[model samples]
Target: MNSMQNYLADTVKSIPPSGIRRFFDLVTQTKGVISLGVGEPDFVTPWHIREACFYALEKGYTMYTSNSGLLELREEIANYMKKKIGVEYSPQREILITIGVSEAVDLALRALLNPGDEVLVPEPSFVSYAPGTVLAYGKAVSVPTYFEDEYRLKPEVLEKYITPRSKILILAYPNNPTGGIMEKEDLEKLRDLIIKNDLIVISDEIYAELTYNGGHVSIASLPGMRDRTIVLNGFSKAYAMTGWRIGYACGHPDIIAAMTKIHQYTIMCAPIMSQMAAIEALRHGESEMRRMVDDYNNRRKIILSGFKEIGLDCFEPKGAFYAFPSIKISGMSSEEFCEKLLMEEKVAVVPGNAFGANGEGHIRCCYAASIKNIEIAIERMGNFLARHRKG
Candidate 1:
């Protein structure tokens, strides 16, 4: 058995299990725990969207879609991109439906990376970016973003990380963990650096619809960035279709073709019913999605206020359904703070460092739960803080 362990890939062996999943597993074992840990939406997929999937099932639409996905779904995605981001794509050639945004990210990394190529990933962002880069045999270099900068990746900060071998940059706006967003002007600031460096951008815009402070901007929408940016989005967050696992990637035809080659061999296509439901989501699910966003915005306000009242410093999250509050008053590392809170208060949240090193001394509290749970969790967290706070 010990010798057989050597057969495992070194890259796979190096990566640790997801920190988020580790806490989630612990929560499942504990009783009476109110979880604010996972990044999933609390709302169910709207009835109409579910109905569409049911209709597809009744119509016997169960089979592998074209490796690129159903043309109709691709067309809907094209229309969605044009309307939302002011960018147009050839659905037939530039879009490849993926299992989820997770799969899209993986595909983009695998298709674009050469061994030892560097991928510049902004920290306090998603947990998967760095590991995914590693799995693709690429180097993951962290570019730390701070709360003082509203967690936006600044041009100067980014430029310092670029090297001759830095082939890709992963941008996740309406970001996870910290809930930071990069507005149009912010993206424009990075445009020149990206162009000069000749880097391909994998823009993960899964939370675009959840932006509250202003409209979400795609780096791809900026002049000269279209062909070089691979846009990944899906029905998971906005449409509350997490279990459905439908996502798509849009980029230059050559890149899309390359990604599709891997995707066909590996994933083949997203579920046919999910594709049908996503079409309904793009066409008529807007009102429901907006309703959910409005509710999350309300929760966002409550959670921020709750943190303030508890004397924790939390940055204003303009997008997404999470509030990242500093737990430094307790003088504990993020993991210690979260574990103690979960054990004592029975309130669960992910440690900030799970996202990256910059996330240390903070905790990611998802506000996607019901108002009552949010209120209760806040009170419990207050109790936990009072006991652990250092002078």
Candidate 2:
């Protein structure tokens, strides 16, 4: 008989599973593991937001929302975007609620690609970008950014990767894994390049609310770029609502309409209760959001200082809750370092190679963990490093 595996599509079989999930699964089976592998916030979703969901259920709002999502939530999202980032979008035509930034990204890729297209992706980025590009029948061209440059994707680096086939540039400043942010001046350099290349952009700003230094900047707000940028954001990081699984895409109406068409057929809509809860999150949960960001900032300090004390070279993460530290002193590859550390000390952090090949020789430690856990993990890591250095 023919094998069932042989029946699967070649494209589906070719995609590799997420690298983060390997360490996570190991931690779940091991006892007393202190994990910094995942990027989820340690905080519970705010009570008032939960209460909004409960109230929606009480009012029997369990039916599917309109394929475009609740108008109320979209309006609130529009207002929030304007106040927070100085970007204006029409709630009716330019906003589409999605199943978190994950689906938003997928939809954007699907809407824009027409097979054999090229997407410029900055590395040491989140795991999904390259795979998502491939799934949408596009090629992902990796643009390397180094630790010496603080992991910022320079305009020159971006220019080298562009060709006639290049269609999109995926940007995730306040980036995952590295936690590096692009300043307005840094983005200004790209504005000319993007215009010169006639490229569209997919800007993932999921960590917008957690930025330090100056506030987060959306490239879509830059002059002459709004029509060519798709901004993907969600409530997962800022509102600690990962389980709610609601997000949105904002761009020109034509793109939004195209994304909405796919979302309608595939997702129908995001959960109705989540939409109701999101409205409350955008409208009344501002103070609570700020409180969480404040708490994360405090924990961020502890993690950065602790890494310094451990004698590891760590870049100061200006946004997001991750600390990417070099493990080159131990003479191990990023995967080897992470695996040995986990086995020796039961402290779990993802290897930098999980993000991209350019991330070798470093490890990603997520600080979206409790302060006590962060302290203990750091201590364990220090001990692990000491042993490895001696060996």
Q: Which candidate's lDDT is highest?
A: 1
- What lDDT does the true structure give each of the candidates? 0.94, 0.93
Q: For candidate 2, what is the TM-score?
A: 0.98
lDDT of 1 by residue, 282-369 (tens): 9999999999999999999999999999999999998888889999999999999989999999999999999989899999999999
Model 2 per-residue lDDT tens digits across residues 1-391: 7679989887778888898998999999989999999899999999999999999999999999888899999999999999988999999999999999999999999999999999999999999999999999999999999888888889988999999999999999899999999989899999999989999999999999889888999999899999999999999999999999999999999999999999988999999999999999998999999999999999999999999998999989999999999898899998888888888899999999999999888899999899999999999999988888734
lDDT of 1 at 349: 98
Ten consecutive residues with minimal summed lDDT in candidate 2?
A: 382-391
Give the worst 10-residue stretch by lDDT in candidate 1.
1-10
Show the colliding residue pairs in model 2: none
CA deviation > 4 Å runs, candidate 1: 2-4
